[model samples]
Target: MIITGEDIGKKFGKTWIFRNQNFEIQSGEITSITGKNGSGKSTLLQIIAGYLTPSQGTIYANGDQIDEQKHHSVFIGPYTEVIEEFTLKEFLNFHQQFKKPVCSIEEMANSASLPLDKMIGDFSTGMKQRTKLITAFFFENDAIFMDEPTSNLDDEGFQWWKDLLKKIDQRLVIIASNDQEEIKCCSKQLNL
Candidate 1:
């Protein structure tokens, strides 16, 4: 898969978050969007994931224009919502209805060290983050977009995140973060 952004820009009201940015991201590469706070890294990632529309220019995936409703990418971010009302098992089952995971639900739960019967609402921040990562990494998708992936993770969880990345080395992975350790794995970087 290839994602191309041509003169992409985003603005809210009178202020421009970012403008005139261009990039070409391809499969089998881990790309990091690096910038300081409020530097539009997350905004740019959202635009690429089809969660938000750019105020200017265009974004294309594999030679086709990106459509918000039809894009087949998986996104995991601080703002990405999860069904807190469902148990881990229930949530995984529900997710399976939309997209098949690369692994079984039991394997994902075990790898994340999360109890299948536990409600997502009851999980700790780190656990929830793990759940999110597991869902994103263990799913079948052409592209994966992550924003501050290590936000709530501990040292062990951080290592787990890095290890998980190794398993999906052939997929198109895009991350928006300021963490040096997290960015270390990326071969291509777009600094805002």
Candidate 2:
């Protein structure tokens, strides 16, 4: 997949979140979107993922214009929406059931380090994050978006992210993070 944008901008009231940003993310390489607090990093990712639209300019995914209602990219989803009521296994199962090019049940469990029988309702926040990561990774889409991946992780968990960063394929990842370390792992970067 190839994502390209030019002169993209957004605003709320008088606060200009972003303006005139240009970028392109391609398959077979990992791209990181980085910036400081209030720099519109999350909003930019949401736009690229087709959840929100930029006020001006254009965004193309795979050479086609992004239509929010028809675009099918997968996101790890905001932390707020992760299912706290479901077991980790159950959650993965539910996601796989609806996702296109879904993976087998066993593959989903292993991809996210989820113990197929474990109760996700009782998992620690880090564990939950891990499960979310797995779900994002297991999805079959060419474009995958994640925001603030290290929000609740510890030092060791951060290191794990760094390690994983090197291994992520460019053909499949777009990470939006404020952490310099995480952004460094990206083969290329787009700053807003």
Candidate 3:
């Protein structure tokens, strides 16, 4: 898969967040977007993932125009919220209703070290990040977008993430982060 953004830009009201950005991201590679705070790294990632629309220009996936509703990308970010009221099992079941999981429920639960009956609201910050990462990684998708993926992770959790990243194949991975270790995983980068 190839994602091409042409002269992309985004604005909130009259304030432009980013402008005149262009790039082509292909499959089987990890790409990072880096910038100081509020430099639009997350915005660009959101636009590429089809979660946010660009105020100007267009994006294409494998030569076809990208449609947010129909796009088959998995995005995990701090701003992306899960149903805190649901148990892990309930949330997994709910998610499976829309998209079939690549792993079994038991496997996912084990991999994330999550109790099946535990409520998401009760999970620690690290646990939640683990849950989100597992959910995104366990799905078969064309693209994966991660914004500040290691925000709440501890040393062990950080290593776990690095190990997990090695297992990714073929899919296009786009990460928006400032972590040096995380940025090193990417073969290419887009600096905002």
Candidate 4:
């Protein structure tokens, strides 16, 4: 898939978070969005993921206008929340009703080193981040948007994240982060 944007701009009331932005993201490649804090990096990613609308621009995917409800995309970020009431296995099962996972629940749990029976609410920050990454990466989606993906990761988790990044092929993966390791794995970059 190819996602293209022209003159993308976003405003909150009287203030403009970003304006007159243009870019493209294609399948089978990873694109990193980088900028300092409060620079609209997350807002841009949200707009691309169809969660937010641009103030004065157009975004299209494969020549068709993009819509959040219709597009098969997932966003992983520091604010992305997990089901606190569900165990790891249950959460995976619940997610299966919406999208097919890239692997079995057991496999995902094993890969993330998560205990299947543990509730998501009890997991540590690193574990929660790992869970989010596993869920986002293992979904069969056309687009994946991530913001500050390595916020709560440890050294081992960083390695796992890097390894997972290498496996992201044939999908439109856009990441918004300042982490050098994450940016280094991307084939292209856009600075806000």
Provide the overall lDDT of each model, using Cα atoms, as 2-decimal numbers: 0.90, 0.74, 0.88, 0.90
Stretches of candidate 1 exceeding 4 Å from the true structure: 68-71
User: Can you write out model 1's per-residue Cα lDDT over 44-115, one digit (the tens) per residue?
Assistant: 999999888999999998888887336557899888778999999999999989887888999998888889
Q: Say what the RMSD of model 2 is.
A: 2.6
Worst 10 residues of 1 by lDDT: 64-73
Clashes of each: 0, 8, 0, 1
Per-model TM-score versus the true fold: 0.96, 0.85, 0.93, 0.96
lDDT of 4 by residue, 1-192 (tens): 999999999999999988899998899989999998888999999989888889989998988888733768889999989998999999999998999888899989888888999999999999999998887788798888999898999999988988988887798899998888889989999998
Error of 1 at 22 (Å): 0.8
Which residue pairs show backbone clashes in model 1?
Answer: none
> Candidate 2 or 4, higher lDDT?
4
C-alpha-based local distance difference test score of model 1: 0.90
TM-score: the better of candidates 2 and 3: 3
Q: List ranges where model 4 is wrong by over 4 Å.
A: none
Give the per-residue lDDT of model 2 (tens digit) for 1-192. Answer: 778897999998888899999987778878888888899888898888888888888998777788833544567644546777887667876786777535676775664455777787777787777777665555666677889787767776667656655665644688888777777777888887
RMSD value for candidate 3: 1.5
Winner on TM-score (1 vs 2): 1
Better of 1 and 3 by TM-score: 1
